[model samples]
Target: MAADVDWDPYYGDRRTVLALVGLNLDAAAITARLTGCLLTDDELADGFAAWPGWADPFAGFFPLTDDINPA
Candidate 1:
């Protein structure tokens, strides 16, 4: 995702805010590195509460099992 942003300058503007769900993502670190900032925990929950689609931003790309995979 960071590479995509670096390759395409407009990518940042296209996806201004990123909402990570069902994953232990470091939003602050990501925010500092990429131009597209991630949404906070409260904001993510609010989005899920407001919209059903917001609950799964990855469109079911996440793993089915509860296995830890280091990135």
Candidate 2:
């Protein structure tokens, strides 16, 4: 599963990020977060209906690094 994730942008490195996410999670917690408040199978169906393979609903948490301020 980690192989499928490319989290370097936020994590700086996939291994480091995977470790961070892993520290806060176990199988049960991962299941709960995905099922309880964050995203459920049904919700994912609807969320992904707009686009096929976009991952991470919270990706909008960070603004594009390339975005510039016009002053």
Candidate 3:
């Protein structure tokens, strides 16, 4: 049996939360759990809106490279 860890205490620390998400250990689960805990619904909506191509899952399939030559 795994020990349950209460994540509420860590919610107030943005860096710790972000670092946890960045670890990608269980990103989807972590994101879902932290969704409304750190930010309000409106703030979350605004963040989603501000992220480019966030609405489209296929957006990252063909990543943009910075090596393009403009002639």
Give the alpha carbon lDDT tens digit for every residue of 1-71 in model 1.
57565465643544345566756687775557554335666766686556553545454545677668656
Q: Estimate each model's TM-score.
A: 0.24, 0.20, 0.24
Q: Which pairs clash in model 3?
A: none
Candidate 3 lDDT: 0.52
Model 1, position 64, has a per-residue lDDT of 77
Give one clash count per candidate, in the order shown.
0, 0, 0
Off by over 4 Å in 1: 1-15, 36-71
Model 2 clash count equals: 0
Candidate 2 deviation (Cα RMSD): 12.2
* 1-71 per-residue lDDT for model 2 (tens digits): 56556556643544422333434347775555544445455665686565555566546644677756645
Query: Model 1 lDDT vs. the true structure?
Result: 0.57
Overlapping backbone residue pairs in candidate 3 total: 0
**Predicted model with the maximum lDDT:** 1
Candidate 1 TM-score, C-alpha based: 0.24
